[model samples]
Target: MNTLYFAYPGELETPTGGYGYDRKIIAGLEDLGWQVELVPLGAGFPFPAAETLSQAQTVLEGLPAGAQLVVDGLAFGVMPEAASLACGRLDLVALVHHPLCRETGLSEDEASGLFESERNALGHARHVIVTSHATATQVADLFGVAEERITIVLPGTEKQDFAARGSSGKLKLLSVGTVVRRKGYDLLFAALDGLRECDWHLDIVGGLDADPGCHAALLQQLSGLGLTDRVTFKGAVAPQDLSGFYRQADVFVLASRYEGYGMAYTEALAHGLPVIGSGGGAVADTLPDGAAIYCGTEDTGKLRSALKLLMTNESKRLDMSAAARRAAEALPDWRDAAAQFAVALGGVRR
Candidate 1:
C-alpha cells in the first residue's frame, strides 16, 4: 500500500481554510486507499517559540528514511533548518497555501525574515503544492522556484441549494472570515459607515476569539458608528449551521487584504449570494467577473459605492446572484481536487 506522512500545525479540525483543505484532502487520500499518517506538530506556528521549534525538530527528525512527507507551509515556512535536515532523510514536499511573508500587517524586517526562511525551506523540497495559480506564480517569481516544481490544486466547493433570501425590507449582508488583520474587518466597517442611510443589516460570521484585541477594536468601531443595532457578530458557526446563514442572507462580502485561496468567496457563490470583495491574491482567480464587485484592499470609497449599488438595485443583485450560481457550477469538486493532489504526490514519488 502507498504510505504518506502529513505534517501540520495545530489540530486538524481547526475552522480555518488551510485546516479545512488539509482535512478534506486527508479524507480524500484515505478514500483513494493510501495509508496516510497524521503528524500534529507544535501549536505555536508561523511565529513559533524556541521550545516549539525544538519540539518540531525532534518530531521531524524521527521520521523513517525514504518516507514520503508532506508539510503544511504554516509550520514548514519557519523551519528551514528542520526542513533541510528532514529532506536528507525523507522525500519531502511542501503544501503552501500562500507565501507566509505575504500575510498582512507584518513589518518589513519580519516579512523579509519569513521570506528568506520560506525560500530556503522550499528549495529543499522535491515538489511544492499550492492552492491557486496566483500562488504558483508568486512562489516562482518571489521564491525562485521553477513553475514545473509547483502544482496548483484549487479548493473544492460543495454543490448546495441556492440561497432563499428573506423577504425582509432590509438588505442582509453576510461576511465570513476570522477577525484578523488580514481579513480586513476594519476596512469593511469603514466602508459600511457611510451606507447607514440605506436600509441594511450585516452579519459578521467568524471567530472573534482568534484575535480578541481586533474583536474589541471592531466592537468599539461599531459603537462609535452607532451601528451596533444593525450589525451582528455571529462568531464562528458550525458547518451545518453555515448553510442556514447563507440561506437567510441576500448578499455576501469580505474585504480581505489577501487570500491564498478565497474559499469563503467560493462558498458564497455556491450559495448564490452576490459577492463584494478585494481583487487581491487568488480572489480574482476564484471569483469570475460579473459575479462579484471587486475593490482594492484599502478602497473604502469604492466598496461603499458597490454596496450602495447592490443595496438599492434589486435587478442588479439578482443578476449577480445568478452569475454567482453559474460560476459555482463551473468550479471543481473535492474529488477532482483530490485526484489532482494524488497526481502531484505520484510525481514526487517518481
Candidate 2:
C-alpha cells in the first residue's frame, strides 16, 4: 500500500472539531486503499515546548522520501520557520480548517507571528485544503493566495435516523462543541436567558479541551445567568451518545461567533432537527436556505426572536426539519470526500 503520513501536533485525546476532522480524513483515506499512519507530536502541541519541538523535528526527519504528508494547519501555523524546514524535506500538504491568524484573543505579536508563519507554510504546501469557501476567501485576502489553489472539502457528519417531533414534549435547545469563548457559549447563555419565560430545556454538550480557565469562566457565567437548572452541561459525550442527543432534541442551536465549517449544525440537520445558528462565516453557506434562523450576531433580542419563532410555531419547525434533512442528504459522505481528495493528490508524483 502507498503510505500517507498524517502528522498532527495534538494527540488522539484532543477534543475539538479539528481533531475529529483529522480522524475522519485518516479513516476515509485508509478505506480508499491508502496506508495512513497517524503520527502524533504529543501534548505540548502547536505551541510546543523545546522538547516537543525537538521531537516533532525528529519525526519530520525520519519520513520516507516521496511519501505524501498531510499536516494540520495548527501544527504548522505557529512556526513558519519549522514549516520551511519541513517543506525542504517532505511533500507536505496542509488541511486548514481555518488560519490561526483568525483565532480570537491573541496578543498582537502572537497574531503577527502566526499570520506570517501560516502564509509561509501555506505557500510551501503542494495543496491547501480548507473546509469552506468562506475560509478560502479569507485565505486569499489575508495571504494573497489565489482562490484556484485552494480546495474546499466540507466536513462529513455521521448518519442517523431523524426522530419524529413529539408535540407535547418539552422543547430541547441543543448546542455542541468545546467549551471555548470563541464558540460564543457566553452569547448562547445570554440568548437562553431571554427564553426564561418559555418551557424549554438547554443541553450544552462539550468539555474543555485546550483551555480550562475559559471553560470555568463560561460555567460561572451560565450559573450567574440562573440557568443551572435549565441547562445541562453533558461534558464530552462519546460518539455513540452524541447520536442519541441529536435524536432527542427538537431544535438545535449553534451560537458560535464564527466557524470555518459548522459540523454540529450538519449533524443536527442530519437528525431532522431544525437548526438555529449564528449567520457568521460559513454557517449560511453550509446550511439549507430555510433549515435555520441565522442570527448575524450575538444580539439577545434576535436570538430570542429566532428561538420564539422556531419553538412556538410547530409547522415552521416541521418544515425546516424536513429542509434540514434534505440538506444533510445532499452532503457527500466521507468516502466521497476521500475520493475527491485522492484525485487531487493523484496529480502529485509518487
Return the number of clashes found in candidate 1. 0
Give candidate 2 regions above 4 Å deviation: none
Q: Model 2 RMSD to the real structure?
A: 1.7
What are the TM-scores, per candidate, against the unseen true structure? 0.97, 0.95
For candidate 1, lDDT tens digit of each residue in 1-350?
88999999987777788888998899888889889999988787899889998998899988888999999999989989998898887989999999999988789999999999999999999899999999999999999999889999999888998754534698999999888889988888898999989999999888887779889998999999888898899988776688888878898999998999999999999999999998578886777899898887678899899999999988888899899999999999888888899999998884
Tens-place lDDT per residue, model 2, 166-278, is 68668888898887777787887887787777889988888766679888887788788888888887888776678888887889987887788888888888899998888
Question: lDDT of each model, Cα atoms only?
Answer: 0.89, 0.79
Residue 135 in model 1: lDDT? 95
User: lDDT value for candidate 2?
Assistant: 0.79
What's model 2's lDDT at 248? 79
Reference-based lDDT, residue 212, model 1: 92
